[model samples]
Target: MVVERDELLDESCRGAAPLPQEADRVRLDLPRRDDLPDIMYLANNHRIAANLATMPHPFSLEDAKALVQKAEAAHGNSAFFAIRLRTTGRFIGVARYANVEEGMPVHVGYWLGEPFWGQGFATEAVHALVDHAFTHGTMDELTAACRVTNPASRRVLVKSGFQYRDQSMIRSLGAGGSVPIERYNLERAIWKSLRTWGRVAS
Candidate 1:
C-alpha cells in the first residue's frame, strides 16, 4: 500500500520527516493519480461534502484530480494524506494540516466517506496526523473545526485530545451558505502529557 517512488511529494518530504504514517488499521500517505476514481466516487456524496467547508457536492472526477494535484504541489509546508486501509489499500477518506504562514498555528482537518462513518477510522487517522504534526514539526498547537451539526466529527476531535475552543462560521460550498462550526485546539504540551498518561495506564 506504499508508493515505491513518489516524485510528486517525495522531494518535499525528504530530510524533513517521514511519510505514509501508519495507525492500527490505516495508513496516511500522499494521494496518487490512481486514486482519482475512488476519490470521485466516495467524495461525490452530499453527506460527506456538507460537513466540509470547501468540498462541493456532486464532486466529479475532475475535482478528484484537482485534489491529488493540489497534494502533489503542497511543497512540504502542508501534508495531505489519503486515508487508506493497510490491508486492502482502499481509499476511504482524506486528512491534512496546513498553516497560512510560518510560525502560525496549523489547522488540521479530515473527512471520511459516509459508509466509513461510526467505525473509529476517523479517530485513528486523526491521531496519526496529530502525532506527525507535534512530533516532527515545531508548532506549539494545532486547531480544528467541525460543523455544529456534526457530532461525530466533534467527538473525534475530543477523543484525539482537542479541547473545545469556540464557535465560528464558515461558508460551505456543499451546503450553499454559511454554516456554524465548533472550533477546537490541542496544545503540544497537552498532547505529550496525554501520550505519557496513556502509556502509564497501558
Candidate 2:
C-alpha cells in the first residue's frame, strides 16, 4: 500500500517533510502531553508490556509524559508517532523508528491498545511508518524484533516487508528479565522494489 501524506503536522515546513502521515485508516503524529491519559490507559496492560522491550508495566502518567518529552526531544534523529483512528481521531497506540546509538541501524516498533488488536491497525500503522522512514530519512535499512512468543507481531513485520534475520536476547523492563527475540530487517532496495511493484501488504 502506498502511504499518503494527509496533512502536514508542521505546516511551517511544508515542503520539507510530513511530520504526520496517514495510511488507509490510521494517522501518525508526534505524541503530545494531552495524549497522556489515552496513552496510559492503552499502554498499562501487562499483556501489551510483556511483548515490548522497554515499556514498564503499570505504565503511569509520568511515563506517558516522559514518552511525549522524549519524542519532542528526538527532533529528526528518531520518529515517534502516536497512532490514532482516522475517522474518529482517537488515540490507539504508538509507532516508532528509533536510533539505537549514533551509528547503529534504526529499529522499528509499535504497540496498540488491547481493544484495537486483531484489526489490522498495527500493520497499517507500520506501513505508514516504514514509508516515512524510507521516503524522508536516509537510513538504508530498518530493523525490528518481536518476542519469540509474539506471532501476531511477527506477522506484522512480515507484512511490512521485513525479512527474518536472526535471533537474539534483550532485557524487557515489562517482562522483568531478558527474553528471546526474532530479528528482522528491511533494506531500502527491497522497499523501493516493493513500492515499484506495488507489493507492500496492506
Candidate 3:
C-alpha cells in the first residue's frame, strides 16, 4: 500500500493511530531515554543478538544509550524507531532504514524481542516501515540481509515482499565474526504489483 507522504508522517507522529489494537502495536515516534532499559533487555538476548549485524552479544544499558544518541544525531540519510505495542504500550523492538546511497538503494533493518516472535508483529511493523521508507525516503529499491541460517527471518522478509537475491560471505560487524548472509531486494514496481494483486483478491 502506497501511503501518501503527508499522511504517513502524520500517522507516524500520531503513533500510527487507527491501527489495530489487538497487540497494542505502533511505530516509534522518537526514541526516548526511557526506552533504553527495555531495548537493552530485548536486544541482548542470544536469539536476537545472533541475527543482527550491529547488536552486541553482551549488550549493556550504556550501549543502548550510545545507540540512541547516534541515531538522534543521524538525519535524512538514516532513521531509527522503537517498535511498541499500543495496547499494553510496551516497547518490543527496534527498526530503521540506513546506509542510503543517494541514487542507488536504501537498506532496511529491524529486530524484535524474543517474546514477540511467532506473532505477526514483525511482519506488520515491517510492512509499515517499508511503506514509510518508499513514501518518505529517497529510494526506488529497498534491500535487507539475513543470516543464511535464519529461516524465520527469511520468512518475514519474504512475507514483506522482499525476494531473495543472492548470498555472500560477510564479516559480522555485530557478532565479531564472519558469516554468510542472504540478501533480499524489492523494487517499487514489484511492490506495487504485489499490493495490486492483494487488493484484487480482497
- Is candidate 2 or 3 superior in TM-score? 2
C-alpha lDDT score of every prediction, in listed order: 0.77, 0.77, 0.65
Clashing pairs in 2: none
Worst 10 residues of 1 by lDDT: 1-10
After aligning candidate 1 to the native by TM-score, how far in Å is the CA of 35 from where it should be?
1.0
Candidate 1 clashes between residue pairs 3 or more apart in a chain or in different chains: none
Model 3: lDDT equals 0.65
RMSD of each: 5.6, 6.0, 6.8
In terms of lDDT, the best-performing candidate is 2
- Considering TM-score, where higher is better, how would the candidates rank from best to worst? 2, 1, 3
Worst 10 residues of 3 by lDDT: 1-10
Per-candidate TM vs. native? 0.88, 0.88, 0.80
Against the true structure, candidate 1 reaches a TM-score of 0.88
Among residues 3 or more apart in sequence or in different chains, the pairs in candidate 3 whose N, CA or C atoms overlap within 3 Å are: 24-85, 24-86, 24-87, 25-86
Cα lDDT tens digits, model 1, 1-202, are 0000122233243223578899999999878899888899898988877777778678988888877876764444457788999999899988877774556677788888778888889988999989988887778888888888888887888888999989988777777898888888899999999898772121
Once model 3 is optimally superposed onto the true structure by TM-score, how far is the C-alpha of residue 170 displaced, in angstroms?
1.7
